[model samples]
Target chain A: MTPRPQQEPTCHGEDYAPFERALLNDYQHELPLVPRPFAAIGEQLGVSEQAVLEALQRFREQGVLSRVGATLKPGAVGAATLAAMGIPERDLEQVAAIVSARPEVNHNYEREHELNLWFVAMAADDAALRAALTAIENETGYPLLDLRLVCDYHLDLGFDIQWTSANETDA
Target chain B: MDVSERDRRLIGALQAGLPLVRRPYAVIGEAVDMSESEVLRRIAALRDAGVIRRFGVIVRHHELGYRANAMMVWAVPEHQVDSLGERVAESPQVTLCYRRRPAPPQWPYNLYCMVHGRDRETVLAVRDELVARHGLEGMEHRVLFSGRRFKQRGARYLAPKQEAIGREANHGRA
Candidate 1:
């Protein structure tokens, strides 16, 4: 892992308007499944439909919000597994690029360990998943640790944003 | 449960995200040649079928100041995994929890959960509380803090080439 840098903690919410904060904090899930969903959200947020739409657009452009869409259950539409590889420090970048380029590989990270490069691989089926992992192994010339999930105990609730802690509101 | 061809098209259209328009479903319907009502119905059906686990705003935690995260893995007794995993997952501090196949002789930790906080000290404190609260003190565990993130994006169930383009267009990351 990269050593933790000594720096002042950034207050991410310093620039966000209350409406923007509410949109992010309150709507992580349970979006109204309606023809005019944004309008519905606007009703709850006490803003016009246009305001809601405009705010989301800005959030997207700023990369603060990923999307307003479905998060598919892992292995529901396809097979998936958590995979890791022990890449030599010198070659981590090259090997990581290869893994990241493959769209099948998602959530790739360099962790603080011998098996540093970790990622999640997904495909249409078990066979396709194996083939993808095998190709990565052959290309990278490193054995992969295929950790298939046995159970997902965490409910699908979205991550709760600690708004007060994340912001310097008093300042 | 098989996903229909139309459902696949819907998923493809949605992989980017719902457009920030008044009638976003109408926009999506136009893309897949689905009626606005039909699109909404399909989305609900998909959700009910457990295909769509969540449907709403997806925030980037790192950008939101929940930067420090650690993947905590524990090797608990086989019989106690289900009970312990449920407890760990129930903790609000733990963002993700799963029982994974442990690579034995080398990696013997099967239970996995992730804790995220604004900084390292907060993350470690959360882990400690979880460990103590769950009676997992004696268990063999390791906390693997995340380092450089190479790539992070939503799962691409469709062709990689197509979704990669859409991913970049939407700035999509999980």
Candidate 2:
């Protein structure tokens, strides 16, 4: 691997209000199951309901928060697999688009490896999921390395962020 | 628990997002023609039944300064997967750790864990620490760093049928 230049950090400390930090770190999981969920969050943070809503909305606009909803358990309602394909560098973009065009593909990422194009194919059931993967293989002309999850130890992707002193500003 | 038509519709509605409002349940209820209390009841019931895993803010790690992320796969003996997976999951740096069925002939890794950090160097240092601490120096492993994210979104389980219909309609147009 070649040495890469360090890139400047995108998120700054002043970007996070005290409440916003709490929302990102504390509320990553286990949102209150209430009629007015935002209101509950506000009460806990000592902020107004409107303020909570606005902050969340702003976060979404800024790409901080992807959504405010449930993180479904994998393979709970359907079937999925981590699949990879090795496409020549020249055909990478074309093959990636073909794979990404499928609605069953919720995640398609190019990674650094011989088998570079990695994606997760999700479907309503096992049969549908298999069909989707098969279709991708037929279309791409590249054999796929299909990896099915056998067991999960910890699948939570959410994590806390530590704001750096350089980025810190009075909230 | 069996998810009925009503529950499917509710899940579809909430899949994209919950309305950012004071009375989000009420807004969601209005969409499905259910009363606010009923929406609350069903959601709570679904949660208890494990149909809904968790309801919360979905933070984008990259936006939060976690620029370096790698999916580390290891070819561990089948017998050692469970114990090793547990240990890997216990690490704070590892957000996701699981045992997967490796594809033979081409792929031969069964254990997977996702490590995230502020930079590539940080992630590599943590990966080294994990390997040393877990005593997995002899295991065959590969680290794949994500390059371009082509697509990413919440799972669309209930909307598949609708999406299929939509696809057909678009096909006809083409």
Candidate 3:
């Protein structure tokens, strides 16, 4: 593989070493399934296996990498829904905490809109997913809007973090 | 393809993450009481079955400096949704594109795509480009920028036991 030209480190208040950039960009998908996966990654990046392992550990500690694991297809094993609720501005934080506390609510975010608190709840099945939504409604005292998925158009292969220089103007 | 009891246990064990080590599969095998080769075979079988969509590093985009995250929703006509969805998914700017049932009266937009950039302007620019290129201007749409991510983690699967363990360790947020 040809070495990428060393572009100027252009990021929004974040500086990633070249090795970190490679790990973030190249190895997001197609990780070798072997006894010594890190060794395989080391061979590709031309570094020792130990170096790869230590870098991954540091990335975990710094919250840069979520994990090196499987991203199961949505509804592959269970049911999930994108649920939202409108909370009074004063109680947004409190209501968010209540919603986020649920183990089934994997993603909870505050968006800019009337129905601000949005989250994705996954359960063992459709019945369990509905139960989780109902419980959230009861706990938060706010009506929950359950938006079930109709179709998925993209296969999530992870993001490409190597931004071109054209995107640097906004930075 | 039917899943065996052992496969379910293996999926439950892997839902959280693979242990970072020289022999992570061996470590997992010990927990699930399977040999290292058995564990590898089961994982491969699961992947082949499309149960595992992706297996690799999961990065936190916000921390990586793609901070301007916007969720764009459009109310496309029913006849055009299928083709338009495929087209929208082709744009490099759109990371996630999907269709969800729209709540009527209050919410009528169905098509959704997410764009992340270094700043809010960049994200909006991408959205505008898509709108113009796709002739989506006449369609009613809304751009919801994500704020204050209270919680984000890997999708917990299989058993409630795995979820219970995940609840204790849900500190990373973007």
Which ranges in model 1 have alpha carbons more than 4 Å from their true place?
A1-12, A165-171, B160-174
lDDT (Cα, tens digit) per residue for candidate 2, span B60-148: 77777788889998899999989999998999989889899988757889999988778999989988998999988999989999988
- Residues forming the 10-long window of minimal summed lDDT in candidate 2 chain A: A1-10
Q: What lDDT tens digits, residue by residue, belong to model 3 across residues A1-171?
A: 223444432443246556666876788776788888889988988888888878887777667788888887767787888998989999999999999998788899999999899999988778888888899889989998899988888877788875444246556
Q: What are the C-alpha RMSDs, in order, of all predicted structures?
A: 5.2, 6.4, 5.2
Candidate-wise lDDT, in order: 0.82, 0.79, 0.80
What is the Å distance of residue A44 in model 2 from its true position? Answer: 1.6
Order candidates by TM-score, high to low.
Answer: 1, 3, 2
Q: Which stretches of candidate 3 lie over 4 Å from their true place?
A: A1-14, A163-171, B1-4, B164-174
lDDT of 1 by residue, B1-174 (tens): 688877877787788787776777777777678899999999999989988888999877776667787899999888999999998898988888999999987789999999888789998898889888989998998889999989976667766654544444344322
Q: Which tens-of-lDDT digit does each residue in B68-137 have in candidate 3?
A: 8989999998888878998999899898899999898788888999998888999999998999998898
Clashing pairs in 1: none
Q: Is candidate 2 or candidate 3 better by TM-score?
A: 3
Worst 10 residues of 1 chain B by lDDT: B165-174
Worst 10 residues of 2 chain B by lDDT: B165-174
> Any runs in candidate 2 off by more than 4 Å, and if so which?
A1-9, A155-157, A166-171, B1-5, B162-174
Tens digits of per-residue lDDT for model 2, A29-69: 77887777888999999998888888887777667788887
